[model samples]
Target: MMSQAAVRQPINVMIVEDDNVTRKYLAAAIQSEPALQLVASFDSVQPALAWLVSTPVDLLLTDLGLPDGSGVDVIRACVGRWPDCGILVITMSSDEDSVLACIEAGAAGYVLKDAGHLDIVRALMDLHSGGSPISPLIARKVLGRMRDAMPASSAPASNADARSLLTRREAAILNLIARGDSYGEVARTLSVSVGTVQTHVKNIYGKLSVHSRGEAVFEAQRRGLLRMATLKAREPG
Candidate 1:
């Protein structure tokens, strides 16, 4: 296992924004960051999706309003081709539906296009570090939606209710993933194969009604299915 103090590699990043100015700004910001390397920049969804087939990037920054198609498609393509890649959406849209759709499609972060270059770069860094950096407005909207989805009269779910949603092993896997462990890291920690971790991930996603790690974590937390303290207590030192 790599020590926490080990030097980290530069994060390879891809950009998919239709607006020329925004795309260039994003590219420049990424290029300026010493820890990040700009791999590919695209002005549309199709080209971005096409390029993803051959090149695997560590992070993807995309805008939702593309001339050819929605950025959600690009997010989905990246998620399918590179499950470990971090996806961040930079867009003007902050509607609940758009935010939920992007989250459901596998985006880990969502920032408004109006963010400064430094802010954008910081968001990318956060996403790469397994933090979901979302615009305040977008975050509020998402939280409001989640709250509305739950029954107003319902009390906090019991541990038994949480356990029923996932097997013990599945919960352990989900806990690790929610804390940002990649499949390989989770496999090594659990003494299982990467393929086995992936199969568990698929089952977790299906049972949680989510398509990505971020969404799975969000849904599980909302459903009161995750006990972070308990999970951490069980982690091997």
Candidate 2:
């Protein structure tokens, strides 16, 4: 007998946007996606948080500005209640405070409203599939922010020496990643296979003792291991 193909379950998704038009557009886009299922959509944090308390969702696309509270609260709720669930920010707020707060709260993706419906769907899908899909421009800004947050004090000589544990190729890959290149983009730039990029990234993350891209960037900066590209941004224009 021929083996039956394993069925794939649609990802459960939720939305929390106060704007009627934007919410409808995002909801329709997600609903129409074959791999996504609209578990629940809310206009405020209260209802969304309530729903999350009882229901398990795979992904959450939330706006930073809610009728009741900032969506960071919702992100915190999801991170706290459902650690496995992926969280995404679908808001116009791209400022350092907003982005850093969401990332620190365990959001896996950040999408601005200007990215439009298709990009939003792509980001949701990417985040749900163990990927962190931050826009390149936003990623650049985030890297700059991470570099700027450095303390006035210098790292211990030993700390800097410890960063030398990264291989030359791994260091190069980390710099490209901090510059906002995706795995595919990194592979293209280096003229290597996508799996090669993944391997390098995994090695870099392990060497740096970080679990996410944001953490990798921050840890690089902390250890004085960030490349000249990121280090130069700290210079005044």
Candidate 3:
């Protein structure tokens, strides 16, 4: 059993969900936990990112779809800024592509929106303990992708053209976006402010010479960077 002292430090959390009702529900659920604190909440990626620059939190929970951008962007930004922080993608998307994208963007967990409060609580606890909590269906898809990629006799090497255009981090973020997370989620996963994520994205755009999310994703794919399933399979345990 955990000691009293261990339980005293509340786990700070930020919530980013576009839906007002769902966001309120999530906030209430998180607030109910004695060990968790809802530090901030936002309905869009831009404002959330703006807040993160000044306020730091231990966990970030977000949805894939937002008014401004994808939640993958948030995850990348978070991971970039606060690599130690935990990120959870709490969304309705169960598509393999979206699930794989969240993981690639550095989310520590993926809980389906339909999951009950208990399931979300379990995911939070798991994340706190350094576990990667993914829904069963997501896990199976990731495993299948891994198995499929393992037999490649000789995978194509990253081309110099692509390598020269994007920095390692930018490339990674692009890959995550292609998979479908929001910018606020990316920021939390990366541990950086939303502005920083935006900067990297802007840099990615400038370097790749592309504008807009779809264009960036397509370009990254053409350059062999949108391999979400492959990347997730290779992530360290």
The candidate that achieves the highest TM-score relative to the unseen native structure: 2
Q: Model 3: per-residue lDDT, tens digit, 81-167? A: 777788988888878788768777877677677644435665676566544455544544544455455434323455555667777
Off by over 4 Å in 3: 1-3, 115-118, 152-237
* Ranking of all candidate structures by their TM-score, best first: 2, 1, 3
lDDT of 2 by residue, 1-237 (tens): 544434677789998999999899988999778889998989999999899898999998889988898999999999899899988887887797888898899887776777443466667765664456665556767766765776657656646586778887888778776765566667787899877877777787788787677777777877777675653453334
What TM-score number comes out for model 3? 0.60
Per-residue lDDT, model 3, residue 174, is: 68
> Where does candidate 2 have its weakest 10-residue lDDT segment?
228-237
**TM-score of predicted model 2?**
0.82
Error of 1 at 2 (Å): 14
How high is each candidate's TM-score?
A: 0.66, 0.82, 0.60
Looking at model 2, residue 195 earns an lDDT score of 77
Question: Which residue segments of model 2 deviate by more than 4 Å?
Answer: 1-5, 115-118, 152-162, 191-196, 228-237
Higher TM-score: candidate 1 or 2? Answer: 2
Query: Total backbone clashes of model 2?
Result: 0
lDDT of 1: 0.78
**C-alpha lDDT of candidate 3 relative to the true structure:** 0.70
Candidate 1 residue-wise lDDT, 1-237, digit = tens: 887547677799999988888788888888888989998999998889889998999999998988988999999999999999999988888788888899888888777775444367777876776556665445445554675687755526454576697988899988776654556667899999877888888899898787666687668767766655644453334
